[model samples]
Target: CNAFSEIHGLTPCYTLNGSVLKDASDTISLDLCSCDFNADGYRLPTEAEWEYAARKTISGMQSGLTASGQVDKYGKEDTSIPEEEVSWSASNAHGSHKVGTAGSPFTEDAPPVAGSGNPNGMGLFDMSGNVCEFVWDWSGRYIESEPGERASGPEAGSERVSRGGSWSEYTPFIYAGDRYSYDPNECYNYLGFRFVRTVK
Candidate 1:
């Protein structure tokens, strides 16, 4: 994996110390690896957490119209801004531009951060575009359940869940609620990830 420490000073040092399954037939087995949740290590956020962080609200903006009648500096109706203003997608980006350069295209690689795009309610950057983020949940159907502190997915499954759309995708998949899946062992250019740690 490319080192991000130079770009983001907060990047942590991760050690790749796990073993991979060499037997192709064993790929479907869930016993290949085990997670120590109580251990101190970085982990992918759950699907619920990822969505919560990505979804933006009117109150989230630092400075922008909240009511329906207000107009932006551009003199356009500010009832609601398009996703292009906050997400990098095919409509705004011909190809992957820098992580945050709102509408600037052809960069063809994940940018360092969301330059001109607006951050989510949590002040997080690049949650909707740039790249799809791998989450901790395995692929499964949504269930009607009571609200909780952390909503985890099914107990086990073959494909892992990935949230947020990539620069290669259209506006629909780039929304905060969009989700997809992939084999845990597979890797792709448009697929990247973020990590979270327990505050303890």
Candidate 2:
């Protein structure tokens, strides 16, 4: 909700005299401040910010380490069942039902439905299975870069970013770091967003 408001709250200021200046004087709810304001209010999370948050310890799927005897819902070694193998999707939902209607006990043959069960490694809920979230990057193709522990993104002025698969999306695309983009002016119910703020 905060994400939606931050982007929506700051409607561009237009005037009959053609004088235009981006306004940063107004304030909306901090809950709604999901964007990055130049120096004012709030805005959507940056691509780097979003990725880091999504993959961070508090709200992401912890990978790399061996499943190390961790057993999946099916009692298989965590390593035997990769993250990709245990994810959920729209088809898994059988349509779009309310969250948590499917109960738990996510099995290998029957993983939990989208929005109907637990979240991934991240503390965040409904990340992969709820609704697709709008990101701050531009619409364009992606090429996973190489060689860095953590990278920011194009040059800061290039590209937009949206992540998380929506209620209607398939399973393969629901990974936390999956991304998409669109024109800022474009609008759609299928496309909503969440915002973040840095207190420092």
Candidate 3:
């Protein structure tokens, strides 16, 4: 993003590691925020942040923190909004389509498509479905935390955490609250990730 950084007058973001997933290892070394794995790079969103962004329990700009299974939904509860209006789950998706095109047609040579589906209240697209996302937390049972505070997940576990259902699942799995875990080495086409950054 050097050009983006240059035009924007600040480093948009730079990842020190590129596609190192196939050879990743245990999380014991960087289980939580006790250490900095990529000091100047974008990191995966924690589970809580993922859910909060989905449901938007707290408004305005707030520092990142952890939470239990409190608010878990891809978008604010809108019984009025049908799932097909914003999500691309098994109900309307044959397979993963391009980003921004919730249920719209896509072509390889076609220019990028943006805002095909309704964005969440936070103005984020394709968050509820299209692809399940890997998060930055270890897999374990939920730990209770005081209100307004974040709960750092388990110290270590055999599997990593993943959230946000994908096109392969029903609409119910597309939202938050269902925390899934998998072996870091195991990658599935339906399994993908979301990118996030905590502005200091």
Candidate 4:
């Protein structure tokens, strides 16, 4: 996570777009260097862990979905908040803000971002606003196809999970439970990520 590194003054280390998944049976000699992650017990966040931090709830997408399973802003619900309460959406943002920008829609007068409106019960900042965050899971297409109860992601390979919405879009739909996937090492100027540390 770049934010954590910036806050702690640690040099960020990562190989852009390395192997997707490494299993016990895989026999490939690739360079796995020490990025100083071991010192802090740092690593990528699991799907559940990442979702918890992003939405603070286990429900599903903040926007309601249609009968066809397509994500839309009809009858969506945020389990983190009241029956239907949302802080971030495409209509409220122009692009990713600096962080902690508060205003109904985060316009020019607002803090420049969303989450500042109020943090979820978990006290996690920017869970639904600002730049989207990434998870350790390999993009799982279906719930049944997932690895296991604690499945990190698709065991078959490399794609990472992306959550939350960007500040540039204008839709109140991409809330918790709404997930996307991207290449692990791939970095976008508008895309950044946060990490979670497991206590156990």
Residue 101 of model 3 has an lDDT of: 66
Predicted structure 2, TM vs. truth: 0.50
**Once superposed on the true structure, which residue ranges of model 3 sit more than 4 Å away at CA?**
1-40, 57-76, 103-112, 146-150, 170-172
Name the regions of candidate 2 deviating beyond 4 angstroms. Answer: 1-40, 58-88, 94-117, 140-159, 170-172
Look at candidate 2 and tell me the lDDT of residue 74: 39
Candidate 2 displacement at residue 191 in angstroms: 1.8
**Please, what is the TM-score per model?**
0.63, 0.50, 0.67, 0.56
- Write one digit per residue (lDDT tens) for candidate 2, span 9-72: 6433221234222343322222122333433334466566665555444322344232111234
Model 1 per-residue lDDT at 20: 24
Segments in model 4 whose C-alpha atoms lie over 4 Å from true places: 1-40, 55-88, 102-116, 142-149, 170-173
Name the candidate, 1 or 3, with the larger TM-score value: 3
Writing each residue's lDDT as its tens digit, candidate 1 over 60-112 gives 42222221112244433454666666666666654554555553333445444
State the lDDT of candidate 4 residue by residue for 20-86, as single tens digits.
2223133222123222333343456766766655443234533322111122233234243431123
Give RMSD (Å) of candidate 4 vs. truth.
8.3
Q: Rank the candidates by lDDT, best first.
A: 3, 1, 4, 2
Q: How much is the lDDT of residue 94 in candidate 3?
A: 62
What local lDDT score does residue 170 receive in model 2, on the 0 to 100 scale?
A: 38
Question: For model 3, what is the error of residue 73's alpha carbon versus the real structure, in angstroms, after optimal superposition?
Answer: 17
